[model samples]
Target: MTLLPDLVSRAAGRHAQRDAVVMGSRRLSYAALEQASNRLARSLIAHGVRRGDRVALWLPKSPEAVVALYGVMKAGAAYVPVDPGAPPARMAWIARNCEVAGLVTCADRIARVDEAFAGRPPMRALWVTDDAADAPRVAGLPTVTWPALAAESAERPAVPAVDADLAYVLYTSGSTGDPKGVMLSHRNALAFVEWAGDTFGVTSEDRLANHAPFHFDLSTFDLFAAARAGAALYPVPPRLFAFPAAVAKSWCEQRLTVWYATPSTLVLFLTRGGLASLDLSALRVLLFAGEVFPVKYLRELMRLAPHARFANLYGPTETNVCTWYDVKGIPADDAPLPIGVPCCNDEALVLDESLKPVPGGGAGELWVRGATVMQGYWGDPGRTALALQSIEVAPGISDRAYRTGDIVRRRADGDLEFLGRRDHQVKTRGYRVELGEIETTLHRHPAVDEAVVVAIPDEEITNRLKAVVVTRPGAAVSEADLRQHCAATLPRYMVPEAIEFRAALPRTSSGKVDRRALQELSS
Candidate 1:
């Protein structure tokens, strides 16, 4: 019923000449990539990865990384990717929680991976790289290496059934707790890819930039969409994101035709290079999502890439892309563009707290109903029930939907306009901040006693990741120093925008952050 593997199979079978994935200095045609994935899939099955098994892929963005992703799925297992750059703790967390049958990583990653999962009984890892074959150059988890076992792998198994079988176990932070898995089925994934390809005018000629981590669900489209459209997907290095000018330079050099990433990233490129410095002449489309995009920056980008189409893409990991806004021209007013119309096979509803639909122009929580909705969260029945289920729909129908937690309003044009989240939780670009996550990080600073992170809207950075962290008496660390400390522990996106020492945080009768009160004061 789903065509994910077959789509790749067909691309090889029929469109073999098309380019599948492109990285610096290497080009993989669909036919060749398909053969590589097939061989890898056979190796996985030979290693005992059965249908519906979980295969954790912890590697950087490279041709091999792409091979492992499709290979795992081709072998009929869910491919769960953990960013190679993640700290040992975060890597172990995702691995243990997802209960991966095995992991595929490079030798550079072996030491940290072994250190984290050393005690976990069910997990094993495989490494690739270096004169790996010479003199046991590979060590640590001597038992864990994929290439060594490939020869032992006897045969490739048949593709698994599409019905109720998982295609991926993409992990996203749990709304109320630690990270949890969102089970996206073959049907769930294929529906989105198919819909996105057609809806966004994605074609074989389109060349997209992949900026999101392989672990993040957004990259699912970036990776698979390339195969789906027979287009080339260029995975940018983390360094380019930091030095966006270099990225802009590469855009000109590579002739990148389409861009899909978070708004924060685009703003950096525009701010760093300005539109005039970069040669974006070949760029025809700019699709952005994962956070609120500022109107000023978008308008500037439109002017810069005058020929490129600007699109507002909105969705969550649980619901693969529910809506889109095609930037036909600058909106007459400046209130950031609406999240736009729902995609084919998708429906959006803005509902009040009681689950009643909000009237036009009234703000409420957004709920998505569609074929693209995920099966459920992995392992947690309580949360799975909360996120995936019936929500203000025909009482008798058996279909389910997802509650996005984002608040928005239906505009007069029938498009959805952006509002903030229903809670203190805020998103920076594509990453979700639990507010509590940052506060917990602040509490770790030796000089800090307690802290509260608040989201303040700004045109450039979008959400002001400001922290009102309380310091102990005579503590040495300052605001800027605290940011450096955070950079060591967390990714740059998670670092607090501004750190302010406080005597005590305000609180409501419930003694929460008194978030509303803090907002009023900040305003």
Candidate 2:
């Protein structure tokens, strides 16, 4: 398939009456999904959203959100998924940065939308997915209710797009106190999706669980792979994420055949979700990524779900699932797992700082080159150039590769073992965060003079953030006060877990904040 929407069209032709998306009491058939998305695409075109434009989806995980994703693609525009739980200011910054042509949201978020736009909406039109009557009108913004959107023709709109065209833009935390957009094309996503579908043997009989949010790259596998195999997709409700018991109950009730999520989530289920008491015999394939899985927890999970085959997927958002390892068994001791060999027609190189290939059994930065690699950071050529470089694979030949900041070492068996990151970027709760971004936010507070954020290693969630602060003289700021300030401009995951007031921060020889010293103290 050249375009992403083709997956849905192909499935609709074969499985017209089959369930495509399922939530609580709601089921949308493949045929219905195709028709609904076609109508939504037509509506977007009528509202001046042209090809190559960007449309933002600002709602939570729901059936409508799924439809909106395909509709944006069908409209020949790239979709930008905004985190529903992000603060208004952060959401506004994303919308402004992407310069979205249209926005899809619900009525309950209208107030927050108003706060984000501040009476000056940037988009050309707004599409309300539910409860339109309760939505308040915003000045200078044309709102389209569901009834109006549904009235459009269900026939597919005539638009031209190619496999190399931009499909979606995912915003990730930037080291400069802003978010950076990663540009991914239809080809980039399909490279990984096709491989995953074939490797996992997904079929119409399989039921896949979409546990990650749409903004995350993991969701691409959940959505496209299911469509490719004509399988049923179950988007676990966002509300159930906080309650591990509810998530476990849903897993048993749904009888999910394929499950893909971060190790942090699985750890939560293993500890508090009551996994031992549940029956997961239907689970055939279980995949984990985003962070290293604690061997102790993984071993216990393997014992509980013996019927499922486990795999470790590793890569950054720029290169989706470059390398993976199938878990046959864990060692008796607490040894770090290998990320495995490259997949999806990708090439892996362990290169030193000078871009020379590292010798066997040596550690170096991981670099990936393949169709799965992203186009680059949207509208930021400098940062893009820094991450993506043209490496000389041979004496007279060079290939473009993305330099992953992660360090890995080649084992004797040819499997690559993952080490820590070379930079300050860390993953917590399956979300990538730049430590400098949190420190920048803290520095903005009037009560903080000097601040440094450190990542404390934890087996459960990968890492927990702790902020060491040297407050300004005469300023009486509490931890709660600083946390509340961060909540206004950053996501919850970016907020520091612990805050300590110090008289002065330790400094290194170069007069830089001593992060290592702070981390030792926090740990």
By TM-score, the best candidate is: 2
Off by over 4 Å in 2: none
lDDT of 1: 0.75
* Pairs of residues clashing in candidate 1: 126-145, 465-497
lDDT, candidate 2, 1-523, per-residue tens: 4799999999999998999999878999999999989999999999999999999998889999999999999999999998888888888888888999999998888878887898988899998898597679767888887777768999989999999998999999999888899999999999999999999999999999999999999999999999998999999888887888898889888899999999999999999899999999999999999999999999999999997899999899999899999999996677978999999888998999999999978999999999899999988999999999999877997999999999999999999999888989999988999999999999999989998899999989999999989999999999999999999999899999899899999889999888888888888
In Å, residue 87's CA in model 1 sits off its true spot by: 0.9
**The best candidate in terms of lDDT:** 2
Error of 1 at 303 (Å): 1.7
| TM-scores for every predicted model | 0.90, 0.98
TM-score of decoy 2: 0.98
Candidate 1 residue lDDT tens string, 107-203? 6766666667665535543536222554232233334344554453333357647646888887765434366788988788777788777866788
Question: What is the Å distance of residue 50 in model 1 from its true position?
Answer: 1.6
What lDDT score belongs to each candidate, Candidate 1 first?
0.75, 0.92
